[model samples]
Target: MSIKITKMIAKTHCYIGQNHPNYVIIHETDNWAKGANSRAHATAMKNGNLDGTVHYYVDSQECYQTLEHQDGAWAVGDGKGKYGITNKNSINIEICVNPESNYYVAVDRAAQLAAMLLNQYGWDTSHLKRHYDASRKHCPRRILDEGLWDNFVKCTKSYMKKGTNAGSVKPVKEEEPAKLYRVRKTWADSKSQIGAYAYLDNAKIACPAGYSVYDWTGKNVYTNTTAKTGTQATKLKGLTPADLIKKIGPLFTADQLKTGVLASVSMAQFILESGWGKSGLTQKANNAFGMKQNLSGNTWPGSKWDGKSVVSMRTGEQKKNGEHYTITANFRRYPCIEDSIGDHSAYLAGAKNGNALRYAGLKGCKDYKKAATIIKNGGYATDINYVNQLCRIIEQYKLTDYDVKAGNTGTDSKPAATTPTSTTTQKKTFKVKVTANDLRIRKGPGTDYAFTGKYTGKGRFTIVEEKGGWGRLKSGAGWICLTVNCVTRV
Candidate 1:
């Protein structure tokens, strides 16, 4: 809690002369260079001739004040006037994300520093803004990628309340009902579910195109029809995988709209976890996602199951040491597939691990890959290839099409890569700094070309060739923007 603040104020020429700060801006140094910590940045600021600068540089161990709080730094000049947060009005805090430093620790330290600044200025979280907020450039890539901005704000608020950063924050608990019923086409196909009801008759009455009603433990209690009346489209190569995507598209889309969960990513989980709705657990318990009732239970008020109904089944699990074992565990069973899907969405939006949502920022994530990564990093699964598996499923099925259309919403629907009218041709191999968080890799050298589904991260990469202001990645990934704000010669 007692973060050491080391002062290394910059020369007058390095930063603007004066600043009456009204807000605090958060940023991240996209430098993975070795030893690029708080002190390193401070050292750079102390000397003259710096192209850009910030008020403070924070790492895991300490915070470095690079400039007096009154002086304006070069950061966020491009983002001026958006929040009325110009360089003159904002004090920038750059969190070091170098390879050698601890990212989570750095984030905490930054949050603490922000809290301290808020204390100094007597301002609230409304005073905080990501550098991206102003410039539209992805500065704190990880925070946006993993959806940590809200948690960061909450963490800062907690620090402000506690007055001391000694203990962690915890989410408040809520209440739940005793039982729930699910409505679905089939017990095995969880994605085909339509609704979850607190009462059995209501669930039965709400069942659509499927005369099936199951209990929380996945036991089929009632069935009025023996056949599926809904039409089924021809499958690709006779595969059942994601074949039900069309049937359950609305369910996931609704979830995305209401909860900010990426429909594509959650649909991919339905494929992997339920084995395309053909898994034994799905068939019997209607638990498509291997929904185990963990110790935390359902933190969401909407999903706070009474914890009375569960199906015991043998499940395979892996260890960090590449070890695998099977054990009988109690998995939360859905009365219908809809309940499972709804409950899954509720869990993501509401479940927390001591003040942080289990899948923080997943509720409204637009990028499927980022959502998948958040799920994987949030410890949703043990499969080392979990993210890749989910992403493959999403891209392969074009599940993103089901995501809510907010005009170029999903990652698959990336914003147009505008070509530069002025072209630059360079033959020699060189490195360029990739600042775009979602710089698409095109199969050809222009926006008209098809996307390779690959993207450039915030870092440096080798460009083997250049044409029309685009650089061809030496790794054969694809061509990316070489002249746009995203890419610049390192």
Candidate 2:
């Protein structure tokens, strides 16, 4: 499939392109207004109606190139600051998702065009970035809001590998698959007994002097003393209702706490869903909120464990007729309590979930009772009395105190507190030379960020700001992780 690039008439005074474009910035038109598409955007650019310019406009049908690859477009709002990728070093591509157009189809074509550009420029997926990365204006709002960024990247990578030939490869040794074996309780209580040994011999050795060994699937392998597996299994760490509140009270992010989600509601939901973190799935998997394994085609990102290894436990579902029945379903497993809390916050926010517009009213609401009602009405829980139960939990334990501490003043009159900033001070600008192989300068501080360009051996850049060991390159070239010793100060 070839991407048709329609060029527009050059405006004499428009942006000048860079000779070597190093970054690809993705954006959405967000103009759901009538007749919005590649052609309309191209017309706007041609007619001088648009102030900012982009290199390409991708709709469901075709891609329009309004500016040459050598010219820079003012697509990212960052402008030509010290970080000048917006108009100096990056090619901007906008996807058309008007009210009438199919956004999914537009995004699909956009990804294809992005892959083609990457291949043409000899760039990798690391160079692909959203407008949000350049400046957190939420430009590609729907895409990031719906958690489809990963899916888009996956699509790009898939297209990148399409025609590459594998040719001949040397035979490689394969390692044994990891194994999980269980030890009976008599050998040691399940809590003390190491769960899931990597080897059967290790499990046998760990079975104490007399207990039997069983596979993780609970199949009996051997028996020593009494041949009877002890019936008692050690309980996982159990927290009292008060302890649960204290444990999770301070864990909420400032953004989440400010989003109008009541801390009392959050804590109550955790208690109700996790059963004070004592439920089988909660104990085994640390999934405190009982979130489902996946949403549509999207699973929770950055799961430490194999997401497929889920804990299926019985849950109560209430029908419209007020009848309750137990059913077994797989739930997501988190690596730690923090992950669970973070996911819970994202779920309530809904924007990070696939349903970006759903439960929007729950965010930033001051009334805990109203927040619970909104959650219930938004289909968050099946129980009819879910709101009442949440309210009861909040009242029973005075969880409102935590909400108050979270900066919810009970009245919606005052603006929420500003997001807390890191205490680390940025060091003064200094020059540095690239010391590592092909060090990438990213749009942000973390590896999760998109690369603006790569600096090979001996390449130098001026670091404008430093935070968390990441140096922001001068002239908006992007950021480099200085902690890895990739660049040495000169």
Candidate 3:
């Protein structure tokens, strides 16, 4: 069966970022209807009606490539990835099992398609896995239920032995792994660091008193579970969902008191984006609210960070058609959950889409529903069900109690923290695209002030407060030379 390449016209649900297609996952489309076939399924995905998407659909008559192998599929997430098989490092192929189709012939065609992928990776039948292997769901149900899995593997090996489709597919280069599991107390306070490890288990073992294991992104992944007690010292992976709330809830409340962004809405975002604080980004960067290290080098005012403390990772973004793609950007690294909450609130309170605040009405919004709607309308997220999801989370968690009457009521009102009773001349703010990586940051405006020992990284940064010849960083790290050769006002 020749493969008909029918790529998704727009980005689809098939986004998990770039991966090395080392293993091929076999699945059987459980649809037993007569007309269901490779082309039909591919068209369904292209039209955005499929329940989830896989890379290829194989039938007896034809093999249709629905999604790219480089991007991940939404195929095998049921098991929470306990078996080392993840959507990020595998390829997915679904064999059609419509009642009128020849299921056996379709299985054979799937075997050939698997052979082509294996050839690309220089792999063999052992690397071929089932949806059952990753998620333990009864996928490829017919094959498992009827004792056909063994025969399918044997058929794939036979095709491999014959070298029948060696050069049909291109070789895939492996993505570079994340930098390292650098264990530290906090990314900002690196002097308290002890050791770094390549493996997470080893890092956990080496973590000592008042210290934690951090990934390349500066997330607090592991702490010495035996040495201390409660939320902060507990082993991270072992914490239940309720325990995660215990860890992050207080941080959001503290930030709300200072900025008046709804704690309920922000906490709801934290719940959804970080999978209730169990996602790797939360584990790696401590940004549970899905605060992306955005493409623009934005370090919002009131954020206690320099541009250097960021996790370079892949995050999913979408087009207007709801098609998704992955891009690598910097997510800010937080020393603590409080820092993440503070930075997120600052972003919501100050980030601008031209002259207007992106989530302008979020601050002091007493109504959770209105706050969530404002977030959705501001293009803060692309999910169609974003507002609904946030509302559900808020009500389910009794999160509205966290809201304080600090000013906003869903109108064009400022938070109590910023509601100026008297008018003062606002300083002009602008962006400076720093061309040099070593621009000296100072304690005061002039060159006479002591050095703060921070460098402005090469990126566009917001200059909020200015002195005679220096610009204070919006991040509150320090001030940089405004008239330097490297600093160009954008």
What Cα-based lDDT does every candidate model obtain? 0.67, 0.61, 0.66
Q: How many residue pairs clash in each candidate?
A: 6, 15, 4
Clashing pairs in 1: 182-335, 182-336, 215-335, 260-363, 260-364, 261-363
- What value of lDDT does candidate 3 attain over all alpha carbons? 0.66
lDDT of 3 by residue, 1-490 (tens): 2233445432577674565666799999877677898878988988889867888887756677777677887888776779878777788998898765556556766877887788778997889998877876656765654434654676676666655452244221124333345556787776555444434654554454567788867887777654432233124444444445555666676677788888878888877676555445665556666676562234457875455666544444556664444344457666666667777888888887877788887887878899889988888876555677678667655665555555544342322332211112225798987755456677865444656656786789998875433578888888876543345567
Sort by TM-score, top down from the best: 1, 2, 3
Off by over 4 Å in 2: 17-19, 77-84, 163-490
Candidate with best lDDT: 1
Model 2 C-alpha lDDT per residue in residues 147-243, reported as the tens digit of each score: 4565577666665655221113221112422234566654335533433342454455435434567764567786546332211111224433344
Q: How high is each candidate's TM-score?
A: 0.43, 0.40, 0.39
Give candidate 3 misplaced runs (Cα > 4 Å): 1-236, 295-299, 405-490
- Alpha-carbon error at 176 in model 1, in Å? 44
lDDT string, candidate 1, 427-449, tens digits: 67999876445666889665446
